[model samples]
Target: MSASFIEAMTAAAAQRPNALLTVASDVRPCTTRLAEVVAAGQRMGTRMIAAGILPGDIIGCMLANWREWLVVAVAAAHAGAVMLPIVTIYGAKELGFILRQSGAKWLFTPDSFRNIDYSAVVAGCGELSGLERHIVTGPAFEALESEGAISQPVDVNPEDLALLVFTSGTTADPKGVMHSAQGLLAELETMRLMRGGSDDDAVISPWPPGHVAGALSMYRYLCQGSPLVLMDQWDAALAARLVEQYRVTSSSGTPFHLSGMLAAAEANGHDLSSLRQYLVGAAPVPASLIEACQRRGLAVYHCYGSSEHPTVTSGVVDDPLDKQLHTEGRAIIGSEMRFVDDDGNDVPAGEEGEICTRGPELFMGYLDPVLNEAAFLPGGWYRSGDIGRLDAEGFLLITDRKKDIIIRGGENISSKEVEAVLLGLDAVADAAVVATPDERMGEIVRACIVLSSGASLSLDDIRDHFSAAGIAKQKTPERLSIIDELPRNASGKVLKHALRNCS
Candidate 1:
């Protein structure tokens, strides 16, 4: 287990470098070849430190989705620095915490994406006093040239930090999830085993390359000697065109993004028949949505993953849409899953408990020692903090997040239960339930929602829908807020804190 992911990537790069790396809808080569790009990373890594950037430094990336991000990531790892991904989702406040906590010495960001001043954010980071160098990934940063022939990375080790990934936590602050070169690569092995990629493969995605999925594709797609097509932003119409035009075999995104693609398919009537897989995850995919994809001739594959443990569940072609949409499939080979109650005892089949796992896919640990110990419990099992159950078919069904459960009069009411019922109504496009302060019940269920097009829905309508679904009248939403969109993290999990603030 070398500490350099770029070293492993070098194998693929040497085999092929001019293969299309990224297809940006503009028909430009996203990557010429894997080897050359990685070699460039090695050279860039050497130059950055030569130009005074420190090794093992945390380099922040606050750029939009693009191929350059992938290049920087490889370069960072080759340079022996940890790539601290600062996605576009971070505000200046969230930006400061990640930069300061990761102890970033160099920062790379766009001058402005649309209207937001990312450089200004980097300048603002200067206020926190950790960032020493600022390099923009987009137009603002000066063009960078390779310093020299890619020097082999220095004595790399298995447990060294390769990336500092920030994942949302129950606590107000997001923690930096650390992944070693071996740990992250180990996680990708699960995807490799499941995908069994080939040289003829191609990937279509709008998920930003800054996160793990984006990182996963950097290797997974390259290993197959395939081309990757990327959309800089979530433009469904553009993405549909890429898939149709490129004869793309597969696409990936959160359920929200997939829903956007679905809408684009209806509006533009693009010939997505060329598409084979529309992989969806990060949020629950409604069975109805899965059925709709089937009607549209797109194979909707259910994939559930988090930044902490990417690509956990995947629906197969053989699985019925109901099971696909309902159960995250059994753990892939090399992964083990178990359900444990409050006492850490294994729960009986069909009983609800937190899903715990031990596999090559889990993150190395949180960057902070205290947090790592809590996240990875005794016996090396990582507690998912997600409530789930295993069915007779051995498929895992996630019930709700441990935090998303509403404690109403000390009775644990699953918000997912409320959402499931609400989504059953054709008018309800999506729903999220949270516990709000209440005088009588201590906390009552409140739903923030978005309705489907051409559907007129009211609070009572939603309540009755839940009632028909056999949901307890008490667990039904007492208050409702209709909105255009829910706040979601990079992984597509709804950001309830933002929702809670909408009072």
Candidate 2:
């Protein structure tokens, strides 16, 4: 636990040189050895240091799920630089904010991923004062891989900032969350304790490498030397194929992802008996979906966590059916949770209040100093901004969310940010964004718009406007309703509850 990620990876690779780490993608599917990944990271890290990257420099990466992405992540840790992973879906608006806020010095991206042109996106950002170089992911990037590993080891502390991931919180702008090497390793250990696994287990991760869960999945292979199969993007049919082909044992995702995989397995008649445990979170989980997985001989359990604190509570496979179906499970080992009222007083045993937790896996703090005070309470407990209560048997059940955000297919979208974008449209006089229930995605953005006088708009028009604004498409409102005005209370604040009720 005292060693940094690179140190742990080096030790693990020395012990298991031939361990497998496979990446299954549309472009290429290659199974790499543990030694090969470590050597590549070392070579890349040596090149990075020679290129003038300091120990604490921020390196931004906006690549899709590829083996090269993992190599860059490892290389950042090797060179003692903090890795800031930008979601590939982010456009100029979000990307520019992150680069400017984090002050990233070096950026690594692909020439093109899917339909997005990295060169164009970078150019769209205009100017970045802190960015020293931009390296595209092709022969030029491959050339950065020096011929040999560095002879001297980099001195990295366990408590040093290793990762800076931007999360869409309840605010209009993204919050930069910092994590140390020790914190990430603690998260992996907590996960291991939560789920009992075997040495023969192989994991198929459909998560994008930018998200916190995806970042942790990649770290699992580096720290534990486990065989991991990475998917560049989420494709239910392809996920089923990878699971059957690789005999994958466990995975984690939202209920939406689980439903798709289950449907794909049923339609294709794929043998998915190897997949035993699926950790479902990041959105509301339905009891019916859990029952369906049970009928299919797959063990699906609910988990509770956020970017601030990863894996606070998790359900075990051996838990009773009633508990697994009804609750999000109890706090894992070394974690403490409690419910607090608005006044910060402890709620009664069976009452619902905001869920607060503190553990070794908690993030260090937000990059902006002003946000940290409101994010955490005294005694180092993080306010989850969620309403949940513990049952008599110590299981946590989430009742509602206090934060105004919509989670669509495991991605958190700030409703305020969406509303701000909607208000920028000339056709929109006023806007209020709320979450409407969705059968598949759990929740989606619904916009209640007050159009300007003598102006009109449609869903297609809103989508095109969002595209032109350089915002992520997922934040665009899926369902729209033009109204005379948004209902307001005495204080002139929009009554979001009324909008949700009507939606």
Candidate 3:
């Protein structure tokens, strides 16, 4: 067995080719193969560490989901180098910001993905002077893998940084998320309890490996020796087909992504009975989608957490439908969570406030000191920056992000709550509610909507649609912008911050 249990599975794969994670169409190791990946990482670690790159010096990687990527990642952790994962959608400027901020000395990027030249993106990054190595996926990444990497290992403790994850939260600038091996391992154990993993299980997912969810699946599935069926991109029809073809036991994606899958399955008549649980999160689930999933015998679990505090709140798969309809279920095992007021005092049950957490699952701390001190309570519980209320049963009902709440006439209106109302409207296909800058009433709730295709819906029609549904007049959208499409990130997340400039 390899040093890490996750690697033990990969080593097992070396002898048995049954374990797999491959992107469909043009199947080649972005690193050629796992053996090469392990070799390259070992070589780089020895060559780089001897040259003074510390165990935690961030090594950035941007690639599509490929099996060897995990091998290199495990190799980095074992070699004591911090893994710096960046989004694949980034241009040169954003890539440079991450590389520079993380103090990265090495970068692993694909030559091209869907024909976007990643080399061109990094070419524009500030300076290549600090970068000692630039390995491209196609041929270059494989070249390094062919020559055996240094076998020497470094001494690393559990508290050492294993990953440097970057995220912007609901509405903010991107911040570095440094996670120690111990904390991540704890979260993995929690996930195991939640997932009930097994070697016979077939898992399906489409989240890119650069993000937390994607990376977590890579290691988590490996620990139990499960085969991961991956989609290079989130195409609903293709996903449903893969589930049926792979005989997948579980599937996951963002709420919208899963909704798309359900829609495509309903439209194209794909058999998705293999999926026992439809894991989803990163946004609110509409009532229609919930019903649609429930009809398929696939239970939908809502996840409310972030990169800094991952998998904190999860709705159990067997939760009561009514409880699942209102709240995101209870906290996962091994975490302590509460709703706190503006003054950091814990609020009574059912009172809306920031969701604060204290547990071993949290990241080490944010990279910025000023930000770090402001982000957590003195007792070490990290403030989630999301406003929510815990029911008497300890189920968390999130109202809105603290910054996304609209204060109209001194009443805080959750845009997410209002969006749920808008989604219930028959004419509306999708909606996003935001607090627009207002000269009066502090801020007004405004909605941007995309109507159901072929449905000629007007602004007043939607307002009346909400009003007739018993939605409070004040809670109804004051102003509506009808757009053909909503601004979304690559992961199917509606970027409200991008919508802020729509007006």
Candidate 4:
């Protein structure tokens, strides 16, 4: 798409070396310019090669959304090595599994983060035969950046493996998803076009860099010359402040983040006029949230995608209010979408089916090729495992995940459909629907809810709300648990598997 990640970075640095890149932390925001970040990456890449990293070698990083994480990503790409960004939430058990599974030869992490002793975690990973070095950030890492730049960055093909991101593994162990330089950049360009980024645009990425979205934010800074504001920890008040302070134009997160930021802004009387578009996905978006954003004069829209396919469909700011609110928009340029039944046959138009996509932005395959067999349908289409239907205008309405359908007394209930109804209620702040075991009904809808502040709701109240919505009686949540918050992975998707085990 742009030659490669490093090529894009190098070109952008030459064009906009003074562009700002800020990292917001608890203490203060650390800001740097494009030239400095590129120089740091080049130095680190040289040091990596001096330490024996080769093309295609996997370098794993288990860090938060720190500035150094971006530098290391650039370093990895510059050296033609694959970057494996492990989420900081992962412990030694999960970390060990990923390192061993990915066969990563190098790892970069801090000694500790947020009171978690990552050095101890690395020590506890036991003996990893393939691991050559585990470099902790500090003097050791700073020394690497002090090295002289490489005479020449390694040349890599556009299709060479450049990124290895693991799924959130809400159900099973995480799978190592591989992405080539071309695929990652293609997705980046699609997003850049979707957001209508410009040199004047400033983006605040609240996601952890270990996630694909975060990685792309860093690349967007290096490649597109868009100023980036990164947050290590998610604080709604802080995010609201940063958005106003920096005049951020575009950002993306789940409904949880968007709602929280809006609340924080309202509480502090902060005017978030700088924000132009807030791209939302990775969870079921509530229509009320969209309505709330609209009331505040914010452009919020739904986007549908996952790790395997970063972005399949995304709504735009100019779409009709109904389309923007109700559907994840049509396929972006260069992407194709199809619908298929469980039998792997094409479903008729307007019929719900598993969403299949194939395009330049699609991932090559999982690192564990065995997992790829079931991941893709015949004819190179990647099975997204999500169920949705296309409208006459090509807008996609995602009903539920294939696994998310709750069968209650032989009737299929879309969890999102029920959750949408629940969210329409005044008291319900956030909700997640899961299938709970039942003695006679096979499985019933169980809703875990987070209520609004100073608001209250009972099972009967929820039932009444659903009754008012004119939805099927069976779709009403048979079981309800009002909790503080729904469990979420880094990308803000609900951990439905964890909820299934909850009593």
Candidate 5:
């Protein structure tokens, strides 16, 4: 048998059957012990095979960060099925696109969450050509468990595809990034070395399960037999309470989450001293945020990565505050990173250029062949499309992004996607979306528009249009600016840098 995550998790459970696998919250709190988690996965894996989900078939999961999500993910691995995690916040448009693109054989979702009827969303998605079964959590899943389980196990290999992560790019549609079991395991090992926490530790993860960061957190903790406390919805006060109650030793999030937790802890007088490492990334880290977290006895470190390759670089927990605040730290083990010019030649250490990386932790490739060809160089290094430089000591400093995308609260929002939506409105002649500085979210979407003659559109009007178009709420522009004409260069391209400066 190959080095499957399911096999490793089963071994861990055998050694520490009483360890807590997850502390999940829904209407009430629930805990899943390691042994129970393993058994649940086994049962679910049998159900998956009985439902005709074969090895290497795609299984989609569109649920929150609950215990069922973890169980289903591991079950997919045990059944030798490819796991595809869909963001819960995705609307019908995004969800339908993913379901159709991935050709998922089965989908797992909740009946309802946060007052949104997910079943209705699925029903409204028109046609899911390849979806053979839809399983709801709660009572529906229990009914499946009531059926007899299979006695045999599925065979899997380390090089077999295991995960498909859809990440928003410069286009309106998301790109499906693939990963093998071996690659993901290599990444987990690197993360373990970079951010140390043992089985005795507990992790408080607020990131959505759809993102690579959240999935990595779940798998990494399971591999180490650590306990995970998940938050279905992000509330700083609730997170602070959970940290204190569970004595969470490690956590990860963007600057916004870290800042909110600090504010909540200060306001409510919650003790957060149990936190040893808080890996902060997904957006530019502010010096003030790191300083505040460190003062509150939280070890905040800047980390860098993407959907294609998670955890490329990160600061050590014991590193100086200056290094943690200024740079993204050295590359983690098993990762080879470099900065190159347009010709793919290596740039000087201190010069800014495109960041490229390749290693065991790198993802397999994009789902689209054309995208894969464009994303890699001749030497198999994945082009990051980010502008950065390495210091003399190999610490990376990200200067800018080659793609015009705004990251708000760790979610990648394509400026062009929003711009396309705005241009579809009759009241808009031309539109360009840019990132606006914000103290909390790192950056928010701002639209600079040239309205049609005698047409007046407010920010509310634009937002309503986006909502009507079924765009995710996070992609909507938070601010709008009306201008006679966009500043442009000789090539007729709007100067987005100038628009950013207007903020």
Candidate 6:
């Protein structure tokens, strides 16, 4: 295996010079052949060095999924600089926090994207102490590329820090999660082994470049020498067209992405026969959705992991449908998983408890030492803050998040259980269940729902639906609020804390 990302990318480019990294855009489609990608990356690396970027320096990038993003990412690795990918959806507040907290000296972003003037946003950032350079990607980047290429790539140790990705802060401020070059490369190797696909297979990546899923997909493409089709903005109809045009063979995203793709394909009569696998995660997944995708000849696999450690467990394409729908598969190679109680003692198999994991793919630690102290247990295991159970077959069934459960009166209710039942209904498009303040019961279950197109639902309707599903009465939502869309972070995870505060 390659020691660093630069080595892996250079080798892949040499083997497949003609392969392309295609960017799907509504304005215009763009592509960079492997040879050009390599050349540009080398040139940018040299420019970065000339600009006084040193090894171990953090360089922040807040750009969308485009050719420029890939070039800058590889260039950062080539320059031995640690990359900090900031989600494009972040506004000035989040941007300021990440930029200041990460101590990124140089930041690369587009002047404007999707009507957001990032240059203006950067200008408005107050008191970012370490940010000395703000480079825009269009014309400014071209001038930088005018510099000559470097003789060789910068030397970096395998264990050197490479990436600092922050978690989507739903309940609190985002925390930066660091990863070494060796750890991330090892993860790619494990993923390549588990999901075997040739260079000829085209993969569609709709995830934002800042998210770990998007970054990992880009690296996976380079590692496998596959053609990557990146979507700048997600539109289900446009995605369907791209999949048909590019013959996309594999993809990964949350259930929201899968659902949108299915609906678009069905409505537009797009042929999705070329799709071989769609790995779904990042939220509670409904079995009905998986069944629906399977009936349409799309292989839907459930995946489980977190920002701290990705791809802990993922269903295989060849697994039985029941397993795919019910479990998050077994522990991936190089990863160990265990269920534990609040005190960190291991829980017996088939018992519900918090999931703890230790793996080669795990992040080095949070940027804050205080946060790191609270993140791990006595062993090396990272507390996942998720509740789950391991079945006899070793498949993991994630029941709920540790903090997501609601206590109505004296009974505990899993919000995921109620949401799952709600999603199983034909009229519900999306749902998030959270605890609402109750005078008598202390806290009661309240559901924030997004109804299917042209469908309506009431509190009574939700109660009847839960009752029909045989869910416990306490778990049924006592109040329902129909909204146009559920509030979500960039990763497609519903912000339940936001829902809890909603009137």
Candidate with best TM-score: 2
lDDT-superior candidate, 2 or 6: 2
lDDT of 1 by residue, 240-347 (tens): 777777777777776656777667877998777767676666555567778787887777776655667775667666677667767887776667777888778888
Instruction: Kindly give the number of clashing pairs for every candidate.
Output: 6, 0, 4, 0, 0, 0
| Model 6 C-alpha lDDT per residue in residues 401-498, reported as the tens digit of each score | 66666655323456765677789888999888898876445578888888899898888887787655434366678888888899899999988878
Give the residue spans of candidate 6 off by over 4 A: 169-171, 404-503
TM-score of each: 0.77, 0.98, 0.76, 0.81, 0.97, 0.81
Native-structure RMSD, model 6: 10.7
**Ten residues in sequence with the least summed lDDT for candidate 1:** 138-147
As for lDDT, the candidate ahead, 1 or 2, is 2
> Which candidate would rank higher by TM-score, 2 or 3?
2
Model 3 misplacement above 4 A: 1-18, 25-53, 147-150, 170-172, 404-503
By lDDT: ranked, best first: 2, 5, 4, 6, 3, 1
Identify the runs in model 2 with alpha carbons over 4 angstroms from their true place.
Answer: none
User: Once superposed on the true structure, which residue ranges of model 1 sit more than 4 Å away at CA?
Assistant: 23-31, 52-55, 138-143, 146-148, 221-225, 405-503
Off by over 4 Å in 4: 27-29, 404-503
Off by over 4 Å in 5: 21-28, 146-150
lDDT, each prediction:
0.69, 0.88, 0.71, 0.82, 0.84, 0.80
lDDT of 5 by residue, 1-503 (tens): 44787777778788878777545465535676877766777788888887788999999999888777777877898889999999988888888989899999989998888776888888878899899988988887766554456446687888878999898877778899999988988888777766665667888888898999888877865655777788888899989888998898989898889889888988999989898888888888888878877777777888889999887888988887778889998888878888898888898778999999988889999887679877998889999999999887788889989988999999998887889899999999999999998888988999999999999999899888987877888998889899998999999999999999884
The sequence of per-residue lDDT tens digits that candidate 3 reaches over residues 28-47 is 42313334444455665555
